[model samples]
Target: MPLNPEIEACFEEMRDIRRHLHTCPEIGLETAGTAAFVKEQLDGFGIDHQDIGANSVLAIVEGRGPGKTIAFRADMDGLEITEETGLPYQSRTEGRMHACGHDGHTATMLTFARYLADHRDFDGTALLLFQSGEEGFGGAVKIIEDGLFEKYKIDLMFGLHNWPGHAENHIIVHPGAAMASEDRFDVTIRGKSGHASSPHLCVEPFAAVADFIGGAQSIITRMVSAHDKAVISITQVHGGSAYNIIPDEVVIRGNVRTTDSGVQDLIEESLGRLADGLASIYGVQTSFAYHRKHPVLTNSTPEPAMKAAARVVGEENVRTKELPAMGSEDFAFYMQHTKGCFVWVGNGMDSPVLHNSKFDFNDHGILVGASYFAELLKEVTRQP
Candidate 1:
């Protein structure tokens, strides 16, 4: 089916909603304003909804009869970037912007909810999830721990992200491993503090930090298979405070991304072993803390979901074999409990990359996304 006229007509309103969200982007689990905005809209539609976690919102739409229950999730958190888009509705909050198109995601989901509420042509229930802290705060985990799945029986769940490189309105879905797993580590190296004049008196952890940082890459290049995809990046490093005195300790922090769990385990083990070996050689005490944040987002059963997308965007516009991205998503948490698929909608190649200061969600993709969700709902909830 082509884009619904009702949804096409609502594009302007959805764009306005997206712009309003972009103006006041919130970060992490502190999305009180965003949640309130979503709740107000849901209330306007007279749809039953409730608050999950501290700032996430969940809304339900019941159909005429009993069937399978499905879910659509949209992340509501913004990045730490300051807006450089310079649009009339630019972000008012400094150092916070919806550079990842989450504003667009929320707007699309809201539009879908409005449509579903107005027309009850299907069976079962439709759950709309406005998740927060998808950036790194584990909002999905918090909501699940709060008994989200236990409260509602969802058979299948689907989520989408706006992609910058593909053509506008194009859809990409993968059967397995749509996105990589994310794991963070903090390594602290401790050594004796001494005066700058006394070179031999201090153990000097700076050397150990340098050695470990340089050697950690070997985990991916040598240890991991070349056929498999994995990445280890040292994003942060903190060491000496004063120029004259050698600090007692230095800390290194970074993240690892992989498509396989075994590779993830190998990376963590290699990191700890590298840190330990470096500390011993440099005569420093080392502490390595590995935090497994989000697992790999794999689509165990993607045929039905992919077919629904193809029906909406036409088979030519639907891509089923796109290369998986190295970026991570917390939606992996949902896939652990229920069979789900995470797809990517094109945000246009002209648009800036995600997390960039100037990036804004393409308003043109709103109708395409909302219509796709609506179509998927019809397909999944069809009476058997």
Candidate 2:
């Protein structure tokens, strides 16, 4: 379907909003300025809204008639990366950038909010959720704990993320397990510290760190079934300060990503066991801390939502089948409480991949995303 003229006309305005957000990217739950800007826009539209958590905003737009109440979400967080896209309106905040296209997500939701406010043709209420800390600070959990679902009755919910490496403006709506669950771990191994020349006197931890790193990989390659998908990555290793000294302690931090909760549990248990065995063998003390970040984002029942998306982007542009991604999203938290589907809106195959220093949200997706949300509101909330 072609873009609605009204929505198409707002493209430049949305682009401007996106650029402005890109210039002043905020990280995690400290999205005060971004929330303020979003609130200002919502207030201009005369929509009813309120602040949820420290840096999240929620707006309600009641339709002309009564029907099911639906919710749509947009994440409002930036990565810790420095701006390298070199766009005229690149990040003004040093060491912070919207390399994940969150700027576009927020702008698209704002545009959809405007549409919902101006034309209340649907039957029920539409809740607009502007969330923060989706990059990994557990903002979604904070909002839920703040009584987001308890205060408001939402029958259905929906969310979108910009996907690179796909055709521009295309939509991918898989039915289940759209993304993986993220669990992070930190391991500290303590040993006797001594000079490098006194090898016999010192029980150095460098060997234990090396063995743990190598053995951690073996958990995925050997313990995990080849049919199942699991990834254990040791991204950071810290130890010795001076070349002449053997450090007393070594700290290793990494994360595990899996589609199944069972696999997640297995990896965590195996990791702890391996660390303990290594510590016993090396006569060193070891402490391991495992933290589950985000659950797997699954669209368990996506047919209705997929059809709604098809109405806006046409069936040809909607991809119903695709492999699940290893990345994780906190939108899974929302889905856990309510029935909803998370989808991907193509950011263009040639565009820079997300989280890359050069990555930027494609302006071309703003209108399409807004139009999809608008159409989805109409489809899901129509009088039955």
Query: After superposition on all CA atoms, what RMSD does each candidate show versus the true structure?
Result: 1.8, 1.9
Q: In terms of TM-score, how similar is model 2 to the real structure?
A: 0.94
| TM-score for each model | 0.94, 0.94
- Model 2 lowest lDDT segment of ten: 375-384
lDDT (Cα, tens digit) per residue for candidate 1, span 1-384: 778789998888888999999999999999999999999999998898999976999998888888888889999999998888899999998999999999999999999988988987788888999999999899999899989999988899999999999888689988899999999999999999999888599988888888898889878889999988899999999878787999998899999999988899999999999999987799999999999988999988788777787887888999888888999999999999999888999999888899999888988778888988888887777656
Once fitted onto the true fold, the runs of candidate 2 whose alpha carbons sit more than 4 angstroms away are 195-201
Model 1: per-residue Cα lDDT at residue 379: 76
- CA deviation > 4 Å runs, candidate 1: 195-201, 241-245
Residue by residue across 284-370, what tens digits does model 2's lDDT show? 899999999999897866887788778777889999888889999999999899998999999999998899999989887887889
Reference-based lDDT, residue 47, model 1: 93
